[model samples]
Target: MACQSSLALGLLLLVSCVSWSSATDYTVGDSSGWATSVDYTTWTSGKTFNTGDTLTFNYGSGAHTVDEVSSSDYSSCSASNALSSDSSGTTKTTLKTSGTHYFICGIASHCSNGMKLSVTVAAAASPSTPSSPTTPSTSPGTTTPSTSPPATTTPTATTPSGSMSIGSVRDLAVIGLGGLMGFVLGVF
Candidate 1:
């Protein structure tokens, strides 16, 4: 019974750790909300957007329209061929791919008045697997020496988008705890 309980706890921990990686929801225009005269560029500056993240546009109903458009259309402030348009005052768009995404207000003269947003989305970072250490081997009668220097790895920093990041220290700790629990369950 104790073994079963420990196994269950371990499984729960693993599941929770897996669930920690989730998409982020960014509210456009922040406290100012989505409207004209707001510097969308400034709002996007210093913010890191990743694929699977969502952009929520909040505005007064019927006053403005959230229109997703191509780069050319966005440059011209034209929504005649919008990829998607929403006038519900609460537009939610999930970034499905990594690249530049353009948005603008469909209302007349609103986009030209700086009500447009263009954000570059980066691909979501994949969880890195821990690698096993390699052991150097030598022949029984001969010695082999490596000519090249040992390979080194450089770790890149990733900015977390709201939810817990994959492969983060917390994630590693949870994984380690789960593994320990599993080992204890096996022993019992």
Candidate 2:
């Protein structure tokens, strides 16, 4: 147990060393293909985005790639991060700019099947507050991750200058340990 926690702390330090930043991602195959390509594809149309936003593919999805077709195309997908093309079902490229983003499915006949999407994200109001992508669980139309926001009490105004430790782990591990703790304490 000590070894595992040590590993977790080590990993967290490594990642947190660099502030977290990502492009707003859009999943494929949603009913309307929001932030997705044509109906069955990924990349939504005219979905305003800014620098640092990303569009990631889903598990076991297709071999798709996002790229800028030409000079006048997808300024968002250009210059700063002119990624020619990438094939990763788990993660895709980030939209580092705001412009017409033209991406196509580089896989065979995928484009022909209308597996393409273009979106024009407006200039980011502020770089520090980049748009965050919505997850599938909280999918707009899905019943899960529903519209109702969690209830919570407001925090009191306060100031602090010190840092503290936090135990962050995969959800399953957290839940399993939580159950064990509750059972042992006779609170379950």
Winner by lDDT? 1
Candidate 1 lDDT by residue in tens digits, 1-188: 87778777777876676666457799999988899968999999998888889999999999999999999999999999999999998999999999999999999999999999999999766656555557678879987875555565646565556644455757586767867766985786
User: Worst lDDT window (10 residues) for model 1?
Assistant: 158-167
Per model, state how many residue pairs clash. Answer: 0, 15
Best by TM-score: 1
lDDT of 1 at 160: 50
Kindly list the per-residue Cα lDDT of model 2 for residues 1-188, writing each as its tens digit: 76556556655654553343433455544433322345632335434455667766553345455444543333222322443665555546577777766665555555555655565655654224334545545556658634554444433322133622122223334565555455545632
lDDT of 2 at 11: 54
